[model samples]
Target: MPYARLLTPLLLVCSNVFMTFAWYGHLKYRSVALPKVILISWGIAFFEYLLMVPANRMGSTVYSAPQLKGLQEVITLLVFAGFSTLYLGQALKWNHWAGFGLILVAAWLIFLE
Candidate 1:
């Protein structure tokens, strides 16, 4: 198997962690000024972009554009679920897990040859 197949997801996973923080990690610090928060989020998102761009570039070597996009979405969901539960102390209800499972099934369809 091409290393791109493995490397792309790993980079994407790292990207998503930074993105999750950029997007939602500041909820715990509502008192911070909005400009400061936005600026901080932008800084964090810069790292996300760094990893994401390379992941997509390498992914294109073996995966179609649509496949790469679909895989990214699934990976985003999985990463966000973990981030929300652990870092944010949010409990995932059954429906959330069921919804994620359904999404996974849909994602699996993308890999069919």
Candidate 2:
């Protein structure tokens, strides 16, 4: 695989990890206050954008925008799955794996010429 192709997925995964926390982690801080949570989320989101922009640029060389978007979605799910399992201490059931497989198929279809 080309370096851009390899880096695209890694960067997408990193970007999603930052985004998931930025968007969802604020719920844990809701007791503190909404504005404070929003500020923190924005701070984290800055990092998400940093990685996401580069990922899209690197991926674009080998993929159309729609294909890159699909690739990001698949990477996002995989990152979320790992984050949920390892950080959130959640169990991934068969249904979740099936859903991921379906997403993978969607990715394949999107990338297919």
Candidate 3:
């Protein structure tokens, strides 16, 4: 359980990397044909699903559904923030930080008994 706690979120972080790429990486290559991008994204999505399903399965062993979801959402936000800035060339603004902070607060609340 101790390891699962750490492992689940780590796996999810990796999964989100693939997910972010699958969803947004195409934006960086608009010159590519739409069908080619779709296929490439699909290939990437396969790996995301592979990691995500196990992350959830292992996470479920120690965390509730809402807890897992909240954790995933927070991780997703952080991952996407980096991905967007680095890969998409869009830095997050103050408002985005504020919104992320609010989501963190909400996630904290969800963890309380």
Candidate 4:
């Protein structure tokens, strides 16, 4: 717990990277069989769980459940934005930014008393 405040978010970011891949990495391989894609995604998701479990447990020591969840959501959006643009070559639209901005606002409010 020496760096739980810093380490928690770092772990969360790493976990979200794996999760974005597991949940959306199959989109590039439309020709792949559904069963195969499912298997591959599940395999990738296992790594996500490994990091996510510890992140939540350690984060809980410093942040409330709602705060932790909000933090994770923000991390997810940030990670997915990069993955979508760089890995998938998909450009994010203005609308996507607006929507994600609102979510960021919501995450900010979660820390409020």
Candidate 5:
């Protein structure tokens, strides 16, 4: 389908946002009990699975498994960077960017024909 290529990445982005928050948003509330945090995270992750499963399924039509994985990782890094900076109030240093750049290169390699 013509929409698969475009829609897959969009769904992945949405899914990653929920995922990044589910995994890390609790950091802002360190005082919360561990059990509560885990429960909340699980609840958030439920929405992530809702999008991620379909994203992978639809993405498979136009992209190989490895390509879909590469795309997801790249998108994860990008989403995490923003979530870490904005949501977590953490600054990304130069080395962080450098490491992410290397990962980007790896993703490029995965995409290569």
Candidate 6:
């Protein structure tokens, strides 16, 4: 369980990172043909699922299904923000950070006792 505890979040983070790129990186590939972009995105998504499944299973032991789902969503946003900022050269605006803060609050409420 201890290992799973660590592994769950780590795996989720990795999965989110892969998924963020798989989903949004294609926007940068607009110059490329759609078919090729779709194929590459599909390939990246396969790795996302590979990590996501284990993360959910492992996290389920320590967290409720809803909690795990919320965690995944928060991680997804975080990973996407990082990917967009670094790879897409997008800046994080105050409104964006505020929105993320609101999401974190929602996650906290969802997991609250």
Best by TM-score: 5
lDDT of 1 by residue, 15-109 (tens): 99999999999998999999999999999999999999999999999998878888988999989899888988997899999998888888788
Q: Per-prediction TM-score, please?
A: 0.94, 0.86, 0.96, 0.98, 0.98, 0.94
Clashing pairs in 1: none
Q: Candidate 3: count the clashes.
A: 0
Would you list the rank order by TM-score, best first? 5, 4, 3, 6, 1, 2
Q: Which digits, one per residue and each the tens of the lDDT, describe model 3 over residues 1-113?
A: 77889999999999999999999999999899999999999999999999999999999999999999999999999999999999999999999999999999999988999
Tens-digit lDDT string for candidate 5 (6-35): 999999999999999999999999999999
Name the 10 consecutive residues with the lowest summed lDDT in model 6: 21-30
- lDDT for residue 56 in candidate 4, whole number 0-100: 96
* Candidate lDDT values, in order: 0.92, 0.87, 0.97, 0.96, 0.97, 0.90
lDDT, candidate 4, 1-113, per-residue tens: 67899999999999999999999999999999999999999999999999999999999999999999999999999999999999999989999999999999999999999
Query: How does candidate 4 score on lDDT?
Result: 0.96
- Cα error, residue 105 of model 4, in Å, equals 0.2
Candidate 6 runs further than 4 Å off: none
Model 1 stretches with alpha carbons more than 4 Å out: none
Mark the regions of model 3 whose C-alpha exceeds 4 Å error after superposition: none
Name the runs in model 5 displaced over 4 angstroms. none
Model 2: lDDT equals 0.87
- Runs of candidate 4 with Cα error greater than 4 angstroms are none
